[model samples]
Target: MNRLFAATGFVPKKDIRGIILNRWGHAFVTPQPGFFFDTATRTAPRNTVMKGYGRISFGHAELEGFQHWGPAADQGRRAMTQALKNG
Candidate 1:
C-alpha cells in the first residue's frame, strides 16, 4: 500500500491508499502532509520528551489514484526504482 502517497493530498475517485501517522497520535487517510496542511507536527506538544526522530525518505511524495493523477503513478514508481538500481 502507498501509505506515503496517501499522506499527501490524494483524493481517490475509488479507493484510498492507506493511513498516515503524524507526530501526534493522530491518524490521517487523506491529504495531510504539506506545510499548509500540517505545521504542528514539526514541533512537539505539551511536555513530551524528544527522544528520537526519523528522517523520512529524502524526496517528494506523489499522490497516486484515479482522482489525483491516476493509477499509472504506480508504474512510474516502479520505473524510478528500476532506474535507481540500474545506475
Candidate 2:
C-alpha cells in the first residue's frame, strides 16, 4: 500500500496502521483520529472536545458557518491557518 503510493511519488506516513487492502491492490485507510469530523466524533471524549468542533454541522455548512471555507480558490486557508497556529 505504502509502496504503491511511493511508486507514484506520493509519500505516506509509515507508522499508520489499520489499513484496508482492496482487490485492486490499493490500500485505503481512515485518517488519524481528531483530524476530521467523523473520526473526531468517534474518538474525542465528551466535554473535552466540542460537538462538531463547535460548528453547527459538518461538511459545507459547517465550513461556511465557521468561516473555515474561504471564497473562491482560497478555501480552507483560514482553517489551515488556525490549525497551524493552534498546533
Global CA lDDT of candidate 2, please?
Answer: 0.39
lDDT of 2 by residue, 1-87 (tens): 566667676556655555785654323223344433445335433222323353322222222223232431243454455455555
Give the clashing residue pairs of candidate 2, or none.
none
Q: Write the per-residue lDDT of candidate 1 for residues 1-87, one digit (tens) a residue.
A: 345566776557546566586664333224333422225555322112112123211111232313232444553465456456554
What TM-scores do the predictions have? 0.21, 0.21
What TM-score does candidate 1 reach?
A: 0.21
Q: After superposition, how far is residue 68 of candidate 2 from its true place, in Å?
A: 14
Candidate 2 local lDDT, residue 68:
33
Against the reference, the lDDT scores of all candidates come to: 0.38, 0.39
